[model samples]
Target: MGFQKRPYEPTLFVKIGENGKMLIACLYVDDLIFMGNNKGMFSYFKRSMMNEFKMSDLGRIHYFLGLEVVQSNDGIFVSQKKYAREILNRFKMQHFNPTNIPVEFGLKLTKAGRGKKTDSTFYKQIVGSLMYLTSTILDIMYAISLVSGYMECPTAMHLLAAKRILRYLQETKDFRIFYEKGEKADLIGFTDCDYAEDQDSIKSTSGYVFMLGTGAVSWSSKKQTIVTLSSTEAEFVAATACAC
Candidate 1:
């Protein structure tokens, strides 16, 4: 009951203590998830919630939203393995031949293509689906973002490129993020940018990843807004974006 609502995250509430005791609760519509290191606090909070609201104790979390949660003595592992497979089946790519990589190395793509025009709506649907997968699949983020820019008039080549990501996913859908225990959880980050790689817009893509211990906690892959004059400028812009 003493939990304070987080200012930035409206759905999150926290109970902090000076003796290293803490509790956090998140409310998503009718769903609520709470976790803490103190058993006494957890017991008290569970009783209070049951008194005020009709709720079921689900015990340990096994799944949340579209994420699969697997816990062990080592730590926690999260992924969307089921969702990934569903994506492949939904697009009728469940049996498609797998690819080692999502995109070709150093491949330059533009709106101008000799391939026949494809269904823009279908193309956008693929992009949107892959975008959701990026929540647990960071490897495909850049490729998905690249194909997303051509949603207005996607050609056959653009569709092929988008499906290439699916083929890659077909083989790597079992990938999961593991947050192992007993490791020094240093917040490490890495960033990179390609100088004027986009042929149509001449814009550089900025990508960054921030990791905590064994798994990544923060990351992004986005196209820069401004056209930088040089590689140095592009790097500066990318670094600024990553920092912000």
Candidate 2:
């Protein structure tokens, strides 16, 4: 679809098959995602598509859908450094000082009003941009998820917390996921839980990261569905959630 026609038809679907190898391309708006087992076949398909279409070859998929794609001899690394900078610049926060962490270690974000009020539209715009940035930047999942809870009617404190995340991104803008290829290609998962993390709802937050070989490609941080009485229960719940 043309850039101007994106809103009308936001997705494009294509399938390529050659010599028992199949490749699928899913294009959402301006983002294109391709998957196939055979790298050579995929490359050929991409070239063919470019020949038949007006699309510009991004060259090895370094950036797409807010994710920065890095290909190496070993594997692929994906992150969102560009998305982070876009967010910072959108909020006029590119000049802000960098921080070590996305959020304060012991800080608890609640709906209580404590900070100065600003334009709600600006706050929502920042939140939406950050949410898009998180699609490829899983490192900021926890902080983004926490701040997203206040989207309904964000307060100044919530905006500050969100800004802090931008500050954190400024410090770690160079960080990227390294998908290394090795003998150990098995999928490994890690899970952790925090009991009663949300003071307002008293709900636990669970997080998990899945690594393929030496690189992490999938992860999530979310609040648990049910309340648990103990840390063991919370951990077990988190484990079960990860299993799904």
Best-performing candidate as measured by lDDT: 1
Question: 111-197, model 1: which lDDT tens digit per residue?
Answer: 985499999988888899899988888888789879898999988888889999999999899999999988999999999999999
> In model 1, what are the clashing residue pairs, if there are any?
none
lDDT scores for all predictions? 0.91, 0.78
Where model 2 places Cα greater than 4 Å from the true spot, the runs are: 1-24, 29-59
lDDT string for model 2 (34-70, tens) is: 7767888667777877888777765567666667777
- Stretches of candidate 1 off by over 4 Å are none
TM-score of each: 0.95, 0.79
Clashing pairs in 2: 62-69
Q: What is the Cα-based TM-score of model 1?
A: 0.95
What RMSD value applies to candidate 2?
Answer: 5.4
Which candidate comes out best when scored by TM-score? 1
